[model samples]
Target chain A: MPTADHATGSYPRTARTTPTRAAQRASWDRERVHGILDDGYLCHLGFVRDGAAVVLPTLYARVGERLYVHGSTGSYPLRTASGAPQGLPVCVTVTHVDGLVLARSAFHHSVNYRSVVVHGTARQVTDPAEKAAALDAIVDQAIPGRSADCRPANGKEAAATAVLAIELTEVSAKFRTGGPNDEPEDRELPHWSGVLPVSVSTGAPVAAPDLAAGVALPSYLTAQRSTNA
Target chain B: MPTADHATGSYPRTARTTPTRAAQRASWDRERVHGILDDGYLCHLGFVRDGAAVVLPTLYARVGERLYVHGSTGSYPLRTASGAPQGLPVCVTVTHVDGLVLARSAFHHSVNYRSVVVHGTARQVTDPAEKAAALDAIVDQAIPGRSADCRPANGKEAAATAVLAIELTEVSAKFRTGGPNDEPEDRELPHWSGVLPVSVSTGAPVAAPDLAAGVALPSYLTAQRSTNA
Candidate 1:
């Protein structure tokens, strides 16, 4: 299991849990957490602006122990954090809904999902090497063989992208799996009840017509077709 | 097309569009907006708490002209809005990623996604009739025939649910669809480039073992198995 170490530095309120206890609701073993993160390609990032909360959907990737998020350099929140003292206080979350739990009663009806929330101040990654690695992680996160098959960014292209790294040290994962739990009285209710299983698998890859004729599908690319991970 | 009537109330800044937009950035049509909302099941709702921002995932349904969300009566955020002067200001968003855009150059890479963001204050639905409709909408949103296949909630069950309704008067939709767009110069780079299409569909429904032996599958339930919507 990979753990995020926080000895580098301290962030504001990073260690203090929110009063709602939403930040510390449940503890997750490392494999469960990483598996969820690896299966997800996008995340919903939340932050405060002018005293009101705003949620934005963005692409993200997880490396050894940190998550990398990037966006257009012109986006407000990312640009604002570039020079702010506290950086940008954010609650980053990634979720994967695995199945739908259909309980006998409405109150117990829920979805089986695995979610991870990280509370921290995301800092801009300035080092060129780290920035390159982050970009590769993002590509690989979307498709396993993609990063190596594509051309690396040139100087001008690299300068246009803004990358931020959030260490996943103070993170927590929550999951709800398995079938529904119905009250004993409702068991005799005539309605049918059970779990609706959900999963995602890749179909046969469609190669671009413009592709140079002889370039065959690589092993890494073919591996994704059978992967449910 | 269902157009959002701004005449009912002034649109908030987030949902309001400026008049001087260029042609390329002006794709705010009603059908495009509703299509995005209808295609998604989960929404990310953002709200402010003691000057910090919080985002939570919740189930959502779109009624004829309104968006509905419901949760337990004990949920703090939903309960706190019952007495707030302007109701709780919220940012609700739904997104669906269609494919991965693998640009030849890293900087141009992006995901093909359809997203809708609603900016408004959500009011608690107090009318019993309205609440019942909202609950039905939610069930139908999850599984199209679910509401009719099961017995309707009784008086006690209905009373236990708390529903909130927000008119879709101020909404904005943004989308990035289609294949990867790589720079002209990078087109000749040795790379595998094209869309790896993504989709979600229902799998075989696992019938409860307790179901009466030899009971035929309901037609409505059977229809859902092949539906992508």
Candidate 2:
């Protein structure tokens, strides 16, 4: 494996971004990081709140190398980050569980997953234009082309929402892809050994109870369900 | 809709655990919390490291009111936690995305998810009996009855692993279900509105290249795929 770069083309391998163990599973590739990030809309956003760590599952979208997280204006992270002079230090993590690796030995059991961890100072998006775009990006992330189909946010609606932006300057993508890597001696054990593949699948769309009569299911949504994560 | 319990039948909600907004979506019911935690094995664990917040995706299991997290003995959280006299303060979060709500208005779009957030001081489990049991619970959480089917860890493998236990003292479960909750005025808009139900589905098991010929796929593995996550 090539050494992580400080961004000729990859993210900077800052001290905290480097892995101390299982270095083979970690990558700083820009495109790989984006693919993992783009595959999901929800992220576990972590921030130190009142001297203790807090992790919240929230919506997020990627625009180039920056991430915009959607939250309520009253949410703790949004409120706190807006008040900080230098922005609140935060970590945003996205994960897609690909499979369950059940080995002959319990010690080697694991999940094959693709995950990206981003460390940065989260600054609230205060500019109106940027905030609007961020919200659109978040909506589109969940259902591609969704933003164009829905009504744009009015002033009061936009006021109630919050967006926090974090750059992908210090980030790393770590993943495990193959079958169970059981030890040589354990390979001959009788227990079943293999990868039980798992993935997010969209079921038939359930229309809202109060949806207008003439509205039809969108084509983009139909397309989204056709692909597996 | 009830006040959070400090722990008669529910985990007490501290100031931090209490919801500052969307109070209706938060709950301290012990059973509800357990159901959310048991739905997934992968969790985003957050801890303060070197004056900055770091979040890592890891495996965790619930046993009664306690959580046992598995990691390499040399992993940062395990190593740092063992050195702490009073135990390391950490937060564990689990989320299961149920659906994607596409409202008539972009501002109202959201995800249907069940999430549990646990805040506690993590202590390294040093007792041999407790450690072994925790490992069993961890494996069983992933696949019920799996721990009994596989070879138990040998001394060297067990020594290389670490189990960090955290009591479910301060906890909260927040969730959103049902279809899009669009504004009344927006309900008649031209946009289609509904929830794209999503779920984790397991695929056919792929046997390891060196898997023994006689070992049959476990009954539980097949059953797991038949149910919706």
Candidate 3:
């Protein structure tokens, strides 16, 4: 039985979004998908080069149903994406490993993780307005409400950057939580079994050595310390 | 000038491993590469399927100059790699977000991260001895010294699993540390800029509801909590 929420959500199931293995963990819920994407700013962007595969770690931001990836115009993949007329086929994946599951038997050992995978054709954003917004969103993705604090990009900087936009048409989130699913027979083994909770921790922020005298820590940043912790 | 460690090393640099942008951050030192790989077990494995790029988050372990990826025999990539006589062309990437950098200007905003990218061909481990070792190494990757604590995999369980090994010959580690590199002119902007230190944190372990009465929390796990912190 699939654990997908009642299947009547905004994102309709596609052939590729369906999972053959762990079907129950796959979800097509749009709100659930958005929550997963919003939780993290970093993602692994994968694309094919020549006849092999290449995956790069990059920053990303989600706006409505679309995702914007930050890159330099001089980079190989982004430069190619800017010139491709029909857009480049790509896959964006975000994952958070919540805990380490230690089961009685090694076969049942697993990690508690929530991951969102987005697959679609990505094209460079040429419009000045959208590109500006995308760049601001990328900054805010790392530090919420930060775009308004910094000086807007100059023309030269904007021209040197590339932003690729991909929609959330083909997406799915798979997650595993709680304890390990050890086999019934293995439960009696003399093994210490449990879940070791793991999470992203933020330490005290260190101000820039050259920060101006009048500047102070932003309230949004202090708020994030608790929210993200 | 490229910041690559003086040419001579255990692993030679290839065309793909030489980074174009931010060449100063790329390093070919074998010890540095191993340090980054040993820090995390999760990796994004990329491969081409049906002419489109597919990237999946998977568990991986590093043994000397080899990397073993955990998967089931029924999984798509593992199944294909097993049948291909010449092995499957793939890229395995691991990343750690050390800090979030906030710059005075939007263009200079960045992340402090350490990442290792390996481009090579992966083949299934058919030899039983190597397969067993790979499986144990994977368990230890996530939780050091964990393989010995759990019940070993039975023959039936081992038959259903597949371990893909890829060498570290064409590998490079890219890292960014310290604060953001705001442009000289933007340094005086009235913005509080700095780096928010980010890291993986472990919480108190929660014992399994069905754990045997005699079993107790393992010392190795407690040791990991402080080491990983």
RMSD of each: 4.2, 3.0, 3.7
Could you tell me how far off, in angstroms, the CA of residue A162 lies in candidate 2 after the best superposition? 0.5
Model 2 lDDT per residue over A1-229, tens place: 2224534668878888898889999998888998999998989999998788999999999998799999899998999888997998999999988888999999999889999999999999999999999999998888899999999999999999999999888899999999998999887889999998888888889998888888898898776462233
> Whole-model lDDT for model 1 versus the true structure?
0.68
| Candidate 3 global CA lDDT score | 0.87
Candidate 1 lDDT tens digits, A1-229: 1433334232223432332333343444555666778887788888876766777788888886788987656665678678775678787777776777666566567677777777667787768999898988987887876777778887777887777787776666767777777777776666667767666555565665666556666666566542222
**Proportion of native contacts found in each model?**
0.41, 0.90, 0.85
> What's the residue-level lDDT of A149 in candidate 1?
76
For candidate 3, the TM-score of chain A alone versus the native chain A is 0.93
Task: Give TM-scores for every candidate, taking all chains together and pairing residue i with residue i.
Answer: 0.87, 0.96, 0.95
Over the stretch B72-119, how does candidate 2's per-residue lDDT look in tens digits?
Answer: 888888999999989989999998888888999988898888999999
TM-score of chain B of 2: 0.94
Off by over 4 Å in 1: A1-25, A224-229, B1-26, B154-156, B212-216, B224-229
Ranking by DockQ: 2, 3, 1
Candidate 2 whole-model C-alpha lDDT, 0 to 1: 0.88
Which of candidates 2 and 3 reaches a greater lDDT?
A: 2
- Model 3 per-residue lDDT tens digits across residues B14-88: 888888799999998888888999998999999998998888999999998899999989888888999999999
Q: Write the per-residue lDDT of candidate 1 for residues B19-68, one digit (tens) a residue.
A: 12222433455566667777766788777766666677778898755789
Query: Candidate 3 has which clashing residue pairs, if any?
Result: none
Candidate with the larger DockQ of 1 and 2:
2
lDDT per residue for candidate 3 within A1-229, as digits (tens), equals 1223335665778777887678888887888888888888999999988878899999999998899998888777798798899888999999988889999998889998889899988899999999999999988887889999998999998998889999888889989889989898888988999999888877788999888888989887786452221
